[model samples]
Target: DQQVKQNSPSLSVQEGRISILNCDYTNSMFDYFLWYKKYPAEGPTFLISISSIKDKNEDGRFTVFLNKSAKHLSLHIVPSQPGDSAVYFCAASPNNNDMRFGAGTRLTVKP
Candidate 1:
């Protein structure tokens, strides 16, 4: 089964603080990991990704770390702003075309 899990359905953080997102996976065959950010009624936008061979990936205000041994991954956003308030989804695929997603983590960056 291709099951990706985001245990926490929501998270809140004040502006300019660090916001961390967590995800877990049960499928060992998943080799490509990705994070997507979405606003209401919109499709997800690709944020950052790392291959199974890599442990960490970062892009500016966002960072993703993967621990293969635990089948866990996390996304971190620094200096969060109100604009950053949105739903974040963790996804994985054995290839680029086929994927599975977590329910999502709704991050509210309060002023």
Candidate 2:
């Protein structure tokens, strides 16, 4: 069974709008959650992250929220731009070394 899941396969948003991506996890032992953005051929790049101890973590236009009790997490992009269009993957790890990733959510930001 997959430990991390992204129910939405894709999302579309207008430029300069907000984009929200949802993710869920089955493993409660995961103490760290991360969001990664991937381009066509490039490797996934780290976006934002949240620890089990914190409910929210933000970095400029990217923000990550985690609900430990619910085993749920989300990534929010404010003022989305066309350049932000990419595949987003949610990841979880207990020791920050061994990680499990969601399928991926393709985000299209229309200009």
Candidate number achieving the greatest TM-score relative to the actual structure: 2
lDDT of 2 by residue, 8-59 (tens): 9999999999999999999988999999999998999998889899999999
Candidate 1: Cα lDDT at 5: 97
Clashing pairs in 2: none
Q: Which runs of model 1 end up more than 4 angstroms from their true locations?
A: none
- lDDT tens string, model 1, 44-76? 999999999999998999999999999999999
Q: All candidates' lDDT scores?
A: 0.95, 0.96
Question: Runs in model 2 with CA error above 4 Å?
Answer: none
Question: All candidates' TM-scores?
Answer: 0.96, 0.98
The lDDT, on a scale of 0 to 1, for candidate 1 is: 0.95
lDDT of 2: 0.96
